[model samples]
Target: MSPMGIRLSPLGIGVFCLLGLGVLYHVYSGFLTWRFSFLLGSRTGDTVDLRELLAVSVKAAELGGVEVKAVRESNKLNENSKGKTREGADEKLTRGDLLSNKKMANLITSSFPGVQVNTEEHLSEEDKEAVYWNRGIPNEIKEIVKNPKFVSSESITIWIDPLDATHEYTENLVNYVTTMVCVAVNGKPIIGVIHKPFTGYTAWAMVDGGSNAKTRASYNDKTPTIIVSRSHSGAVKDVTRRSFGNQTKILSAGGSGYKVLSLLDVTGNDQETADVYIHDTYIKKWDICAGNAILSALGGHMTNLKGEDIIYTGSDGNEGGLLASIGMDHDALVEKLSSKITSK
Candidate 1:
């Protein structure tokens, strides 16, 4: 009787103590794992501050604008055709496109190591030595988003269109050109930045972070104005006429980004504003993601002709055609065009 308790060998006591330590170690490790996951925004999908992402995206877009402007001013556009598109039109590419793509990608990747950046241009060895734009976010954006909110970075994809409207740029239609960046999480665009190199104007919006752009007044005219691509105008014009009557004002423009901005009254060329933007063929995700995010932020809508949401995560193109509108009924517009528009 060892002090009126069950007697145990020193070895047994040693083993018992070891087991207790092992259990404590396991519990401690699990606690640490949970804490780590929570901090990394894995546990709670709402852990990442979108403002930080917005700031980074704006900076990247500005840098991209710099590259685009530099190449154009240098008079070394070096335009080349990527190939004929599905519609059998020559797809244009230029030195500005590649250079801007490189600058945008490098900045976003370096700033947020965990983010995935998707660009429209492929880089060459010469792009490796491209000068990076080392600048901070504009104060205008900082003042827009004051309240702190978070989103998960797990499925975040940053879409960068280094130079939108390359064809227009080569043809000296620089006002239609832009450098765009869109922050999409899990296929849904939440942040968008459209920077005009030629005009020195930038428009950015985060889903809930706030925006500098405002929606224009509703199109009250019986015959609404619709903007379409300069290259893909034939099909859209026909369908739009059929859907909205022959009196619909149809304007032709280059760059999907420019057309979308026109809907918001953010035109670089001071051209006539349009009520809607319609595309009757396949368009790339990078072309529309920023616009989509901006419109969504302003309580507008951008979707396929069927009124379905455009996904930005996996595929590169939206084949369902486009119908983007602001300060009007998006569903009604979709209903008007969905059954009539034909995609090629």
Candidate 2:
């Protein structure tokens, strides 16, 4: 048959589509930012999912955001909780509370069965002791601990904070609250996810290469915008001024994740604003890990005030302090910060 007379079969069309997969790869993965916003993105999610842990985190964040925001307008953020446990007027605790550790735990466990979860909130002292003693841990969780360091421990924890910046969230500063999850092996972060529910933004990265994404963010700012804790006040301002000097602008913010988000934020009409996040106080590992991954993926850095990377041994008491930044002078910022004395 002549070429014009030959009709293409369905199998031939499939061959053509397969040949053009490079375009499909870009089209499929390029919209990660958009796909994650709606939690409609398809991804693998098993305890062994590794870098795909990013998508599991996005799912958990969606669940947490939905659960938390549902009660915001009706419950008034349970102002009477006094930021305490869910009791009294906070009994239902489903209000505008940003500390939805349990909800996230539930969502994550349900979604990623066999993956160990540790959040900032939890049970009674006796129950805590029981969990610590492994008096009640399920066999599935026990089987996942491949690390020798965790053999004596409860499990290889996916450290999490369902919602950070509870105070700012209660005060209607919703953007500052975020959901975080981190996977650590041998006390080092291998995978991390930082999800900002209010803005529908999520970012994640891993030390290994299962992630199908890379970063293209600009990493240079002469006069950087510095971010500090909005709710907690300390010598952070003075230190920022002293380190970056009068040229840099200071922004009071809440949540370690939120501050890092500001660095990669592109909501500004002009372009993305990249800044440095400084915290002189101790923050939990879950709070910082997800941000660390995103920053690292973008060729940025985060470390203790002593210019050391956190080992993530799972401690809430972080005395090392935090310094995270992206852009041209990242190393210089770290160098200068190393010398700046922190009174905290």
TM-scores, each model vs. reference: 0.83, 0.67
Top candidate when judged by TM-score against the true structure: 1
lDDT of 2: 0.61
- Return the clash pairs for model 2, or none: 219-327, 219-328, 220-328, 230-253
Candidate 2 structure quality by residue, lDDT tens digits, 154-204: 234577877677766666667677777777666666667676666666566
- What digit string (tens of lDDT, one per residue) describes model 1 on residues 153-268? 67788899999989889988888899999999889999999988888788899997799988776664467898999986658888989999987788899888888888886644
Candidate 2 TM-score to native: 0.67
Worst 10 residues of 1 by lDDT: 38-47
